[model samples]
Target: MPGFLKAYVRWVDSANRAIGYAAMLLIFVMVGILIYSSIMKTVDIPPLWTLEMAQFALMAYFLLGGPYAMQMGAHVRMDLLYSTWSDRRKAQVDCFTIVFLLIYLGFLLYGGLSSTMYALEYDERSFSAWRPYMAPIKIIMTFGVFLMLLQTLSELIKDVAKLRGESLS
Candidate 1:
């Protein structure tokens, strides 16, 4: 079971990395197009939907990278007060924070899924001329939140192992 979980995390990590790169590429392309289109528009060329794509891609970028950020422990932390504590206390604090974070992220997971489902049910699309499906992006947020929850659980296990004087790695 542990091996399976380890494999699953590896797969999710790989998948999120791909998503991150794709979102980056999308953003780059949209920005380039926006510049070109704006220039052409000024010269009486046909207006384009660059702004639409850029907004969508930017949201996707944020949603997709969330899980990767949590896994890396690169998220911002204001631990100055906690850092003064002993090692055992630090572990205790981490465990407590992880519990709260788990709850908060679970809420996000639920909300994102609900929004995605609504979008799908209503066939919601962007108001822009491009009109891409919004449900997919919403669903991505849900997936990312789920990944983040897994990461929190992993952290909790690590902290618990530390409390037990065990190597979580």
Candidate 2:
């Protein structure tokens, strides 16, 4: 592999791995929020924001962890046939199939950005009782999608390198 491609793969993998590790903390945050909610309910002082905040935390966790999952090959796949394939055969198939993934991620990114822009432009707020401003979460979600797109490209590059009998790692 060329130096630039190798660097790109290394950088993206490092970044996603770091982000994913950080995002793991969100689960603890969510759990704490739920525990607080439970305690509040027991005291008859339930908070309106707890449920919504917990949901937001979960969204952040999933989105931010996605690219790392991809890089680590932790995402689920139907492996009845795939498990039996040689690494080179798998890379060949991956190189072809990744185009569909890239296309899907591109469309997802476009929609996410459009929705984020609309949220910012209108100062959108949730319809729930808490009625929190939507832009922050929208921005985060959009950023996550962008990261996933970059990671997908990195995966594609790695697949191509594998096909050429080269290692990007």
Candidate 1 residue runs with Cα over 4 Å from true position: 1-30, 33-39, 46-48, 83-88
lDDT of 1 by residue, 1-169 (tens): 3565556556666766666566557667667877877898889975556676666667666666666676666678787887688877877889987888988988888898889989999999887777888887788668767767776776676667678776545
Off by over 4 Å in 2: none
Per-model TM values vs. the true structure: 0.75, 0.98
Each candidate: RMSD? 3.2, 0.7
Residue 114 of model 1: what lDDT? 87
Query: How many steric clashes between backbone atoms does each model show?
Result: 0, 0
Residue-level lDDT of model 2, residues 1-169, one tens digit each, is 7898889999999999999999999999999999999999999999999999999999999999999999999999999999999999999999899899989989999999999999999999999999999999999899899999999999999988888988877
- Taken over the whole model, the C-alpha lDDT of each candidate is 0.73, 0.94
